[model samples]
Target: MRSEALQNWLNQFTSRSEILKNIRDLEKNNEELFEELLREGLTYEEVKSRYTDFSYYKGLKIPEGARALRAVEVYVGIMDFSDPSVMRLPGWHDGNTPSANLIDTSALFGALSKRIERPFLANKTIYSRSNCLIRYTGEALYQLDWDVLHALICFCRGQFNKRFEVRQIDILKMIGLSKAGYNYDLLKDSIVRLRKTDIYIESSSKSPAMSFSIGEVKSLPKGKRRRIDTFSLILEATILDNNVLALTLDARLKFLFGNNEYGLIDWEKRNKLKNNDIAKKIQCLISGQKTNMQRHRMEKLYQLMGLTSSFKEFTRLLKHACEVLLAAGVIKAYAIPAAPRGAGQDRIITIWTTEIPTPEELQAVGRVAAYACGE
Candidate 1:
């Protein structure tokens, strides 16, 4: 039975019939606490405040430094759970597929690279560029791992703090891999690596330093029986039964992805780049930058890609990658200028015009044109 105070609080949403109905249904399952609180002579607002406090602190061990951060208040009253579309994560929801893949700039820059020869390192700094620093304490991730991570991010974009379900096959398809038995095994390995990996990201320009695993995954048993052959993926914080892979993306990811600190990778273009790992890496770096024309030192590029090849071999590969990018329309032109006598480093200059430019980019172009015309 609903308490009078609970009833009064719910009455305020009379105009939103669907939300009101959902709220009523949810309250039916959660009425005991409200009833007990009402019996204790607590007012409606007091009860609500207490409930909010309880929900915020429930199963969470917030550190002293993190306590100063503001909490994201999610109002359950406005949520329309009856519509499955409403519950879908952003970018991949409702069959409205996004043309580009969204990724945090820090990760896009070079957090994960093609260094897979060494075993997992403990408390090792994987990548550091400019003001951003990334430390990892698990299996060393590579380009494929980056793709897997990006797919997970797409799955949990809007609901970063919430647990959700995803199928293993869906993940495979998202990363442009075939759904084969070997692929399933590979996916499981990647998932385990991601789960065990503890990442510490610090970007002075974005947010305070934070540490968390990329995600958590648990493989469910087959049906009522404990068989383990076929399984789907489920994203949940808690353990559950069934032949599925349960995943929970770390909530701390919001710090990196929020405040427009993320960039969009052209999904089609990336897929087209395919097995050319160097070109793909270059695409990621170029996509994350604001300007279409950019120059990067050859040594810096080599380090950023984590290539183990000799400088001469890397330079040869880079030239080939630039040619590939030009052929794919990812870049209009690229030039590797000859190093001057006594110069320590060579530079690669690239110019491009994206198929779809942001408003800010458009304005910048407009300003450039006006300046060129002496307006």
Candidate 2:
């Protein structure tokens, strides 16, 4: 059972084109929720306007830009922060130039910092200081693509349910995209890629890598469109049929689920994170620390993030992420011990904060720029 406040947040609206469409219906039922929306940065008038006159959404089809009821009545997103650990990838890439190799058998074994665009000479025959690797069955990947996988794994661990049955829109929301803002075709493609994506984990130093995919996905179209919007009147009860399809995860990864491994994430910071993958990874990797601080050896951090950029380039990227996070107030201080090369001692980075900055502090510093695609 959900608290009335949280339930109102989940069940209080209908959507069109994956954008919110039926808030008015919910407002009448939950004034408290409506007020919270205002606190979330919506203006009183904005809140009122959206919910007060949403008479549209009678016979809308999701693909046709009509408002459809989300039908996501029971939000189990609480299982979100359960397990935060991610498998290590052979962290070598062709600088920041994402590779389209499709299937990468060559491991970027401890290949340090990606500063220039060049082929990643990986250590294929050597033993990598990692427990696993990744192989995409098809399509090139984006940094956000990795984040998508991380979110799914967290969802599975949090729910105590190895199998998942989820709506596409719900998944997008969790990954920090507004339903209307993202490209619908791309969203669908992301799902296919994630399902086809495989993760390899080592049971022990001598054991071989074990591979697994995220989950199975299917779309369930509802019967003939009800044509609700043009008719201009809708009962609040109608939006419950919103979830057109659901996705389920593989059970093999369930063994990876549990407390201590998962970190309690700062969702607000995550939602505000721009086009920085290292920054996003850093956010999740250092969640819910007892002293509000975290540290990692440089190599371990690289392996954790699966970085493939050259050492110089990778350091620059790391520097960039820390700058962005610092500006965003995600961290108060950050440092990487400048150890000389061949010193034979470890170089480590640390970030700490007395308090997680509020939304106001973040806004004041200005948000990090979102990456522009193919300019």
Clashes of each: 6, 31
Q: What Cα-based lDDT does every candidate model obtain? A: 0.50, 0.41
Per-candidate RMSD, Å? 13.5, 20.8
Q: Which ranges of candidate 2 are over 4 A from the true structure?
A: 1-143, 150-166, 180-182, 204-243, 288-293, 339-346, 353-375
* Tens-digit lDDT string for candidate 2 (1-375): 123464445544343312244455544576554333332211122222333234355764243111112111111111221232222112222111111111111232122224533232221222233443332223334445554554554444333223455565765766677777454455665556555433343322220111222223233468753221111000011112454334445433332321112334444566566667677666655653456545666666665555555566666677778777777666775665555667312556666655554455444434232211110
Candidate 1 displacement at residue 356 in angstroms? 14
TM-scores of the candidates are 0.57, 0.45
Candidate 1 at residue 237, lDDT? 31
Q: What is the lDDT of residue 203 in candidate 2?
A: 25
RMSD, model 2, all Cα superposed? 20.8
In model 2, which range of ten residues has the least summed lDDT? 229-238
> Could you tell me which 10 consecutive residues in candidate 1 have the lowest summed lDDT?
366-375
**Candidate 1: which stretches are off by over 4 Å?**
1-118, 206-243, 341-344, 355-375
